[model samples]
Target: MPLCFQELVTPLLIDGAVSPLSPQSPLSASFTSVLPYHKDSGILSEAEAKKAQKALADGNLLEVVFAAIETLRRVPSTRVNIAVTGDSGNGMSTFINALRGIGHEEEASAPTGVVRTTQTRASYSFSCFPDVVLWDLPGMGATSQSLEDYIVEMQFSQYDLFIIIASEQFSMNHVMLAKAIEEMGKKFYIVWTKLDMDLSTRMLTEGQLMKNIRENILENLQKTRVRKPPIFLISSLEPSWHDFPKLRDTLKEDLSDIRYHGPLQNLFHAYKEIINDKVTYLQEKIATNSFQNTPGMRDIDDLAECLKTYRLSFGVNDESLQQLARSMGKESSEYKAIMKSQDLQAVITRGWKLKCLTCRVMKMFLILLSYIPSLDALIAPYIRQEKHNRMLEGVAEDTMTVLKKVLKDFTSS
Candidate 1:
């Protein structure tokens, strides 16, 4: 590591961020009271405080603290860091990109390729939020290493989940990874890749294929001595092909609630709430303060500035939202009912009501120009008038007005 990077990543190698936490440290307050485990379940909660206590009590306070900090200090986004590993041509990279909502197989949103990709643990963050990284790791094979080495080296517990990719039946490698993850009390799932290829061959119907896949997963788990195993069937080409939403829901459900979900959500909520509380407190103080030497004029100016900032932040600008809504339409599909209604109106009314308004505005502007009183004197007789400029401006303005109307009508109706 470079000198600067060494300083930056030193915290990750130590215990979770709690070991060096001083009472006055910037991030200390977050870990002091909170715990990683739940009160009722006694499992590590998401809160840094509780995890820190666990570390201290176990005499491995440094490790837990570092881990907690790593989780908390992690980019403020839901990146489910999944280590996807399977045999060659299994489509692990393609699956990752699809899950993150990227485009085609070759032009995946996540990084992948056939260069023995991901020789080391490399993270591919979601475009929506870079913090949600997916790790494309080296495929599993028979190497002279114990399962414990795999668990520790990979830091299995730090990941939100594990996605074991396989094209056909869950293989021995997948079974080993799954069993190890289970033993370590972590979450893992099997993703059956290349389903499209199988379907093309007419080997089995979709339903039959799914049943066989499930049975194979069970068989693999049994072979590995795992009692029960959870599996997800997926095709990167069709991220929404089969139970994608269900898969997402299951992962969220399995996370350490108090430590991962509850504390994370709470931290964001609390940060916002604290800022709000401070604003309320200041308002009360101002209201109760004596008028003398209070600099009321300055206060009024500050209040106006504050109100302006608040309005800009919270109050939606219909114009901007209309533009955004139109841009969004380019990527997203609109409701059939709404699209049908608009198309009908466009046919009957010659595009939209705003088209009429546009015509009126155009006619009015032309009428004003007519009053220029120059008649033929203002222009050379050979300079023929062209409606192109007027038409272009009118079309642009009309489009904006139509977008606004569409947005308003949809929101209201």
Candidate 2:
């Protein structure tokens, strides 16, 4: 399976010998302490933490984490299909060409002209988005076929997004297409093309012309019972002007939403599953090995190492952050500045002696509690598991932060 965002960092989190399973373990002591502050940390709700603890006791932690990782590995291969359709002379082909960031005369450009150029559906790959495919369907009402028949023939259900183009005024065909797309529960945008021609012929000012066109389109769409569909007015001859830039940005944002809902949803679920499973695994470990001894310098060192690994695994390490900066066209320092978990190593190292002192105090406390009958058996495990859960929660939050930043950069690009 492909490497998940969590998998890439799991090795770092689990590396080195700190368990009693290895007698020659580098750790100085079996340091286990359930700090009191973790109880109200809000890492996991009481119900959820109890559920995970139960799962751990049942020995099903590995199975759960593995299943979630498998689901996350499928996200990169998800495909997105977008369909662009309109009347023959409404500049659908030109819009497709412009969207692909190429001139109409370019070899890879979609053919555009006064005549019906796209006789059959053609697919084009977006250079910036490897998994996205754009389909240019022949104009509606080009032949004897009705609009409904044309939609069926084009297999409209295959596309995730639709762009319906119109020239001069919003026609019945545009409204029908918008309504059909809306009914199908898909997203569609209306593009008013040939705006330059209207500006030249109409008596209204540019602002008034755009306002009238937008109001008219919205009015027509309302009649068809299509609510709040995005509308853009632009001259194919001057796509950089008017609403073209806004159109591009809005489409990218909408596509980002579709992409997230399609595959990222699975990844998100997997993330939650892995987090819960990790909590369960840690709770099991704490239950199995508690009140053994006081943690010394070696235990503190091991924890510091673990913190370093956590940072690296989540792509927040200095090297990883630098590489991400280069890929996103930002400075490395900018990423480091925004990253909340970058001080993991420093926090561990700077507070080492104090942490060690606290661990020794916790060990003494556990020893005293053990004398108080059943309190040690019940309270020690719960406290330790809560502390472990809080640590894991911080790591999970950092992972999500990095993932969101990467995704935003990708979609915007």
Candidate topping TM-score: 2
Kindly give the stretch of ten consecutive residues in candidate 2 with the minimal lDDT sum: 2-11
lDDT of 1 by residue, 1-413 (tens): 10010111111132222233221211122223332333432223446544434433222322332443454545343445667766545777677767666654444455566554555566776554444567876566424556667667767777766788888656676777787777777667777877777678767889998888788788768876886656777766766667565676554445323124543444334322322332333334334432213332234323333222221221112222233334334221332223221222332244443344345575575467566757534531112122211222232233233333333322222
Instruction: Quote model 1's TM-score.
Output: 0.42
Q: What overall lDDT goes with each candidate model?
A: 0.47, 0.61
Structural similarity to truth (TM-score) of each candidate: 0.42, 0.52
**Pairs in clash, predicted candidate 2:** none
Residue range 1-413, candidate 2, lDDT tens digits:
21111111111122123221212111111111221112331234444444433322232332222322333334464588999888777888887777777788889888988778899999988777767889999888677798779989999999999989999768888889899999999998888888999999999999999999999989988996798888899987776789988887787677667765644444444344544554454445545654233232224224454444444433355665555455445677875555555654434233444344336677799789989878887876665554434444455465555555554444334
TM-score of 2: 0.52
Candidate 2, residue 117: lDDT: 89
